[model samples]
Target chain A: MSDRGHLKKTAHLAEVPAALEAGPRGAKPRRLVSTRTIVVYGTLFVAAAYYLLPLYVMIVTSLKGMPEIRVGNIFSPPLEITFEPWVKAWSSACTGLNCDGLSRGFWNSVMITVPSTIISIAVASINGYALSNWRFKGADIFFTILIVGAFIPYQVMLYPLVIVLREIGLYGSLAGLVIVHTIFGMPILTLLFRNYFASLPEELFKAARVDGAGFWGIFLKIMVPMSLPIFVVAMILQVTGIWNDFLFGVVFTRPEYYPMTVQLNNIVNSVQGVKEYNVNMAATILTGAFPLLVYFVSGRLFVRGIAAGAVKG
Target chain B: MTGQVTGRATVRAHPGRPSRLTRNLSAKIASIPMMLTAVVVFLGGTLWTVLYSFTSSKLLPRLKFVGLDQYERLWAAPRWLVSIENLAIYGVFSLIFSMVIGFMLAALMDQKIRFENTFRTIFLYPFALSFIVTGLVWQWLLNPEHGIQSVVRAMGWTGFDFNPLYDSSIVIYGILIAALWQGTGLVMCLMLAGLRGIDEDIWKASRVDGIPMWKTYLFVVIPMMRPVFVTTLVIIASGIVRVYDLVVAQTSGGPGIASEVPAKYVYDYMFQAQNLGQGFAASTMMLITVAIIIVPWAYLEFSGGRKRV
Candidate 1:
């Protein structure tokens, strides 16, 4: 209590000189109480409200009956709470003849995402290892090109990629999608692992080399274990990016292999007839659930990974 | 005596030069796969895109040379023009708003507050959700007939009218709001890391001088966090160019193409509108515009003016 009293006195004393210099003589100074905390919390609360308002609306809309949603009371609870829309969104909502809701796209997304993540991360790690550990000729040039390539909007490359994939007879296939994701993901992934590797002490690689380990040997036995944090970060990023990818999935995959985002888009953006807000909300939530789960569970590691140079490039 | 021994060691090391050649050869051989990845995938993809932009390619690649026709159409199209214009506005607003709001959020959380992790997670959960979901959710919330407007009106406040999404003039701002919601979390996280990484001595020194926290953050802390800020700016700029799904999901470039971003325009023409030539041209234009803006920035960033370290 005494320390608190002292803190208040000192805090007041710190502010009085500025007030005395700026305000009228003997004017009652405004309370020098710590409004910093008030302003901070107030701004944060407003921001959080702004951030979470849509999520609240989505949840409320999803829970409400269609009639209630149609009435436009997005914040109000339905007179009858029903999970029917969720059921419909998952099992029976029509996107063309496939009325199996977004579940149709679920397996396709997993197939696309799993391989894309693995191949991209594996390639990136190898690239990162090679660039960081090996002083090979033109290594710097190769790294520069790769980093610059990351900044090129893939939209620019999309038309050309379609042709290239078509020429290789891989166009509109799962493999094509995988290859595209891998190519696009490589820059950021390589940058991530490269930065992580560069930050590591070089002695480890030297020791591995002295032990007669080849390039791959040093990477597998030493670098992989040591780079778990960066790898987790890579996986989080690749998973989210590739899984949520709509354009690539639409362009590269055939109809059967459409990812959930694509399917959700079709369902929600259907230009014909009335748009069902309830079903759309449910489907949107369903489609986003995986990444949201990953974010919530691994947010701390994600932040750490980013701070550790996963996103620095 | 040590110098004489080292000289003798150098002379001895010269004899193993032939074996070193064999090792060098092996290292060269091992680099081939990486070289192929860079040349074929990264460089090849980019080169292919550039080449195709010149061709009159459709759903399938027809290699007929169209020269500057696609580029001409891209410039002439009203939707394409709108897309470019919308992107510029969206980019500026989203970057500034997200950075300011994110820094504010991070600063507030940095005050050693209660439930810091909970608040951080809440702010960040949006980033985890795809732009698709963000767009969908926000679209639903901002819909005039059925969303926040009607909900508030139902609460007996008849003057409540929040329908930015439906208004052609301001719908891009609606999309920007959704983008900022997702993006600010990332900025907050990055800035928080930057804030936490700040040397404790600076804070201690400032406290001893009786400087307030606000002044310290404004004058002292932010300048030190410049690298982090620049990194955030580059990342956010890239996100701006890639602004496809959010606009597609929310407005569908609706209310008369108000939110038509370049990516979406290219996509619509390439896929639905069946104008592949124009689409590729638009794609090329976007690529060039982005390159024009970003290449210089990337060069400056990587060229050691502000080194990554």
Candidate 2:
């Protein structure tokens, strides 16, 4: 009895620190601001500046002409700022036979991203719901396998996927890339939805079942409405990952359906030519515009989604 | 009474056990399409790759058994060795630096400062950009003649030489820094979420007790975020292993294979070098190495009987 009492006390002691660090249980205290706060904020300001420096340099360089770039005070305002580089990068930066720049790959990326995101998210939601709510033999085994698949590096899978796609006559097509993204996106998306669903009141699902709602009906009525936040989060992650992808896009897609990332790569990563700084910076900014816009607009919601997923997972 | 009525109704509706069994069987049958997708796409694809790594193939993937010859050649290749070394250096520095910077940023952001969203968006915006574009931007920004070097020279402080991208000895470090720029924001976001989820009451109690902020964070807050740290570490590890695009975009393993990474080496052999057999062998070795490192960690995670993101 004494030993058990001691163990309980030790556990209680552990809980105390946890509660203390989480801040006083209730009510905001009167301001007793410390110098440490200033120090912390100051450090953050400096770090933010460092993080923003590369972007500043990219923007400034992109605005400069070749002559100004050559003269190169990258931090200073360009002696003659020009949007000519942006125009050239948009329409005339050479990759191969066509000099029509990254604009060509824009629609190709869109066509790939939209359908892939929807299908993957839908499939993942179904898988998550079934795994969490339905009791079936070998369910845990399937979930384990899916989770393990996430750890396998894409490099290991690339050769085989290429062969399989080739065998099916779908290699180097936009459809092939879509399938690849969907397969890769499954583990993370499934994990997200599964955890989210598990956190929801189990009684809600039980009550739905009592109402004679079948599997699809219960999922659509109860789970889908509650899952809006997570769905948006999944979409954000997929759009960013799919749009920014270069290796899979380059290797999987034929030259005709190459995404903007490939064009951006060709423009800036030119090996044998006179390196064009202005064009490279402009191309990069142009290519990155979409995802950056998404993040900028939905910044708060994105953070909240991440926080919710983190806490629940 | 209601339970009896439902039980009788269920019995009356189903009537025969054989028909009930068939109904259950049909439901199972209806689920086959979903199961088939999971199996064919994930398991089948993985198995096919493992099988191909054993074959002697090139360019358009010819399948003929060639024992361990390709693996032998891969182990002996100088460029492949260089690629392995570069990746090791890049992975360690990038992971450490990004984690440190990200954690620091998150701790600061949790202090409830002004313009929190602006700061967050600024830090995280890079993660939204494709590394292909970011890598190019870095390449241009780091160029010897036209970038930081020229800018410094023109400022009349001609001794500022920051041309690691062109230098054989220091080029990989340049790539690592660029990768860190793109990666740190993701770490910050993940860690910030961890920080925020930390109950607010702890801050107040610590303050009331006069436990200094740094000490409180170090001893109390950081320990509570173990799961978040694990998730971030795994994600970063995967990123490190598959780090091909940025290198290709930024340096092309340039200045005589200075910044070559293992993925790029495998890619070159598979496509440009037209030695698919050796490429597969290199990939097999990488898979083995990654598995050796990851399997134990994965086992521990799963063995805890919890699903981890």
Candidate 3:
């Protein structure tokens, strides 16, 4: 096509090619499927298979009857597919005294994840706002310590947090777990929100301050509205993180209030009965469902969040 | 970024008139959680644990110092020694393999392939699952009687021995495989971001100069991605020190504590055995390990790289 014709078509579309190129990093435009293309695709396909194999096993194993699982190869398609294991995994799998199943743990995870995510994001966003916009003496030092403290293994803080929780009279309760999640989630969430708020248009913040908006006023009226995407990113992070947390859930809550991951582990690892591989796989999938859903639904935002969190260093 | 500096400058100019405490009172109140967490939980908790490591507290934390007795006992335990060794093996292999595989995957994904998003999502979805789920899935897959061993035999291979979870010697490698599976996706995503950040013109220049793709990647691309590599190394190292739940779910640190790691050691000592001092000592050692990895990196990152965005 002529340059003028190309300009005419693109000018009406009002979309620049650079804008399309700036989508997710990979996917540069290529011309032909040559030897190089075959090699690249072959390598990616093999690696993708390696990544997908366990998940496929989980799904197929979960769908099979126990007798089929016992007799057939794990790699084969189930001769007779059944959702009985899924039903059992959700309602009847045993974990010691808990014959009630993973549904109870699922509820417990919901109770823990929702409150923990909201409270943690709330505290971290406000703290991030204060750090980025309202500079006070020695703020960066605390910020640095918090970021560095994130790398401190949970082992170092686990017992100490237990003591603190006990002293506060909230030990082994859902409230204690929520508080624990908030405390641990603070560093990364705070860093995430801080960097985000820092990257915002400074003029809007300055203009709001010049209009005599106080700390909470400017935050509620201006920053919150402007940073909704960040809030979603924070929610994505915390929901997946707090939901998938086995250590804190095991450490902070009683068995009756165990999160899905903990209960799933107990149910699978408990040695009292016959090893139900199908039921075990079903329980694993059920426990993993929430984070996997979040990952698939908010795919790009999830990537952006982790990338932002990692690059903040 | 700019507003913070100007805000600081303004505060500095008017420091004496308002007095530091009253200035930005609302902001300070807002930051109380950050301050308390920083000072009390992070700084104080770490210091308190390290101090208590020298005592003989059991079932409770007491201040009657025993002068490294707990450390001596910790170092003397066979389980703790095994845990340390497992962590070393797990850490080194996980680091090397995750970096290598992650980079290779990222490089391939950068080749303008079709369905890039689909490939990325598939590669990364395993990362979304918890270690508990990862462990269980791998446990079932690695089970000798019903898993890969039996399957291979059924396919007419009479003798194929591929059971890592049962063998005490290679149990750590079993855990390592699961770790790499669950983690490398994040590393790949990070590497892809680094590759994308490179200017396209650079690739054009390399192609014009008749540089082979492998040579270009080795000599030019990898060096340009130094920061990404360092960041990934730190992230992986930190994660390696915290490999507790994966071991617990996969092998429960058995066939006889062969897959035990430091974090598991601390948890068992602190909670199960009610030996607070021993847990403190082991946890403090974990802190020391992280410090060894983090401090110098923090120095180089903050001190010499002010120009970084």
What number of clashing residue pairs does each candidate have, in the order they appear?
1, 12, 0
Q: Fnat of candidate 1, please?
A: 0.55
Write out fnat for all predictions, comma-separated. 0.55, 0.51, 0.77
- Ranking the candidates on TM-score from highest down gives 3, 1, 2
Tens-place lDDT digits, model 2, residues B1-309: 122222224566778643433332322343353465457655776676667667888776676877887777777988988998998898889888988888988888876677887788888777777778778778877877767788777779889889999899999999988898887887899998789788766866675576877899899999999878887876787678778888888888888889999889888887778888877788777777678767777777777637544
Judge candidate 2 at residue B182 and give its lDDT. 86
TM-score for all predictions?
Answer: 0.87, 0.86, 0.92
TM match of model 3 to true structure: 0.92
CA lDDT of B300 in candidate 1?
A: 80
Between candidates 2 and 3, the one scoring higher on lDDT is 3
If you assessed candidate 1 against the hidden native complex, which CAPRI class would it receive? acceptable
DockQ, candidate no. 3: 0.49
Candidate 1 stretches with Cα past 4 Å from truth are A1-34, A306-313, B1-34, B55-67, B204-213, B304-309
lDDT of 1 at A211: 70
Candidate 3, B165-187: lDDT as tens digits: 99998989999999889999999
* Model 2 TM-score on a 0 to 1 scale: 0.86
lDDT of 2 at A86: 94
Model 3 over residues A81-100: C-alpha lDDT tens digits?
89999999999989997688
Model 3 alpha-carbon drift over 4 Å, by segment:
A1-33, A310-313, B1-19, B307-309
Would you list the C-alpha lDDT of every candidate in the order shown? Answer: 0.79, 0.76, 0.88
